[model samples]
Target: MFYLTVDILGTISFAISGVLVAMDKKLDVFGVFIIAFVTAVGGGTLRDILIGNTPVGWMQDPIYVFVIFGAVIFGILFRKRLKYFRKSLFLFDTIGIGLYTMVGVEKGLSAGLLPIMCIALGTMTASFGGVIRDILCNEIPVIFRKEIYATACILGGASYFLLRKLPIEDIYAYIGAILIVIGIRLFAVVFKVSLPNIYKVEQ
Candidate 1:
């Protein structure tokens, strides 16, 4: 139940984020829906394919499609209010990564993957959706930037495994790890923190 809830929340978050981006790009209704759909499930689809989860996830479950459709409609209707929030895209994207990271980690554990591989899968699951969305929108993906994006997922995934090693319950660890990812992302954004620039400045 908890896992389902997390997955649904992640779907909604990414869907809304995609809607916002597509709308900002002045896309039509169909374009918006397509972007939202891809942003909500692209990461999970890729992860499933890599792990040999045949048929992928969204195809096996129609709920994800319905959820993305609903989210796109909601985003379009509330776009004005969302614009007022200013950070709406960042907030939803952060939440999406936080939830999706754990979802992927759980899937990895179920598949009996090693801890490092699980963390990699978690990071990929939390990031690839946005990458696809960005590519479609003709923008650079956040994961390719120096932002604390996938790094947060890696850290959170590591924390989840570490927490599981303790005496605490799995649910608590799951929630804690999600919080850690969200917190790290929020902190990074709020403080303007990012990876050090690697390119040499022109004289």
Candidate 2:
């Protein structure tokens, strides 16, 4: 039940983020839906395939489809209000990554993966959706940038494992890890913090 809730929340967040981006690009209605659908499930689909979970997760569960559809509709209707928020896309994307990271981590744990592999899966799960969305939108994927995007997921996944060693409940640990990811991302963006640049500037 908890997993289902988290997955749905993540789906909604990513779907809304996709909608915002597509709308910003002035895409048609069908294009907007496509972007939302892919952005919501692309990562999970890839993760499931990599883990040999055939047919993927969104296919097995029609609820994800319905949830994304609803999210798209919500985004369209409240677009003016969303635009008023200005940073709505960033907000949803951050939330989506945080929730999806834990969802992937949980799946990795269920698959009996090693800690490092679990963290990798978690980072992939939190990132690939946005990657696909950005590619489709013709923008550079955030994960490929010097921003602390995937790093946040790695740290958060590591924190989850560390928390599991404590006496806390799994649910608390899970939520804590999600918050850590979100917090790190928010801190990085708000404070202009990023990975060190490697390219030399031509004077």
Candidate 3:
């Protein structure tokens, strides 16, 4: 149930995020839906393929497709109002990554992967959709920027393993890990903090 909830919410959030970018680019309806669909499912598709989950998650379950359609419709209907709520959209995106990271980590563990591989899978699941979205929209993917984007996913995945060592229920640990990702992301955005650039060329 928890996984289902996370999957739906993350799908909707990413779909809407892609819609916003598509609208900003003045894309047509077909283009908008295409962008939204890929943004919502691309990461999970890649993760499932890497883990040898045949047909992928979205292919096996059509709920993700329906959710993205709903999100695209909602975005289009509320386009004007949504322009004023970019922060809210960002919040949803942050929450999406947090929740999806946990879902991905669980999938990895179920696939008999090691802890480190699980963490990498979790991070990939959380960030690659945004990467695809940005690429399609002709922008630099946030994951490649100096912002603490994908790093939050990694921290959350690490937290999942760390919390598992405790005596609490696994769900609690999962929720705590999600909170860590969201909190770190929110903190970075609120404080305008980003990772420093490591390379500079003198002209």
Each prediction's TM-score versus the true structure? 0.88, 0.86, 0.91
Candidate 2 wrongly placed segments (more than 4 Å): 1-6, 85-92, 200-203
For candidate 1, write residues 66-169 as lDDT tens digits.
99999889989998887675576567678879989998998999999999999989998998988999999999986787789988999999999899999998
After superposition on all C-alphas, the RMSD of every candidate to the true structure, in Å, is 2.2, 2.5, 1.9
Model 3's C-alpha root-mean-square deviation from the true structure amounts to: 1.9
Query: Over all chains combined, what TM-score does candidate 3 have?
Result: 0.91
Looking at model 1, the pairs that clash are: none
| Candidate 3 off by > 4 Å | 1-3, 200-203
Ranking of models by TM-score: 3, 1, 2
Q: Which tens-of-lDDT digit does each residue in 1-203 have in candidate 2?
A: 86566667778888888898899899999999999998889988888988988889888878988999999998899988886755766776787789889988988988999999899899989988889999999999867777899999999999999999999999899999999999999999899899865564433
Top model number, TM-score: 3
Better of 1 and 2 by lDDT: 1
Residue 196, candidate 1: how far off, in angstroms?
1.8
TM-score of decoy 1: 0.88
